[model samples]
Target: MTNLALLGARLLIGALLIGGAVQKALSPGDAGGMLVGLGLPFALVWPALIYDALAGLALWLGVAVRPVALSAAAYCALTSFFHLNVFQATGDAWQMTIFVKNWAIAGGCLALMVAGSGAWALRADRP
Candidate 1:
């Protein structure tokens, strides 16, 4: 049961990242605009898309699970800041919800890091 749960978690997170990359790839102009709005370089969108795809693939394949999970956790936590705009109220309540969701995802990644890949993984790098 635990291994199954871990696999499910991995699948969910991996799919999320992969889907996000696909979305960004489909509409790079939109992604670039968002990055610029967040005070980031528009050129970053390309690298971010690649990183997300690669990281998602690594997690899905259960490769170096602990280290990948740790990196994913950090990625989630840092990216959540992009959604946060506490000072000036933009009247977009869903932004806050997304920010919280990112943190939750980060927490999940932390759990995955501690638990390793579990028994059902492709590589099963058990902690």
Candidate 2:
């Protein structure tokens, strides 16, 4: 039961990251626009996609979960902080929602970092 819960958590986090990467890949213009609008470099699109996808893969594959989760947590926190303008935009609640989601996802990543890989993982612990 415990391991199942952990696996489920991993899947959820992994899927979210991978799905985000896929979306960004499919719409580079939009992703680039958002990055630039947030005062971030547009070139960050590829790095964000690559890092998110890689960390997401680690979550799914249960490899170096602690480090991966920690990195992902930092990513989420950074994105969340920079996207604060979402809350200021008039008549736009969706941005705020996304910001909140980032915090939640960051919390989840922190939890995963502390939990370690439970079971059915490729690399449950450090060598």
TM per prediction? 0.91, 0.92
Error of 2 at 9 (Å): 0.5
Instruction: Report the number of the highest-lDDT candidate.
Output: 2
Q: How far is candidate 2 from the true structure (C-alpha RMSD, Å)?
A: 1.7
| Candidate 1 lDDT over residue span 1-127, tens digit each | 9888988888899998998799889999876876788677999988889988988998898888889889989988887777775313465777788789999999999999999888887799846
lDDT of 2 by residue, 1-127 (tens): 8788888989999999999899889997777887787778899999989987898899999999999999999999888855567567544777788889999999999998888879769987542
lDDT (Cα, 0-100) at 106 in candidate 1: 95
Root-mean-square deviation of each candidate, in angstroms?
1.7, 1.7
Global fold similarity of model 1 (TM-score): 0.91
- The deviation in Å at residue 20 for candidate 1 is 1.0
Q: What is the alpha-carbon lDDT for the whole of candidate 1?
A: 0.85
Q: List the residue pairs that clash in candidate 2.
A: none
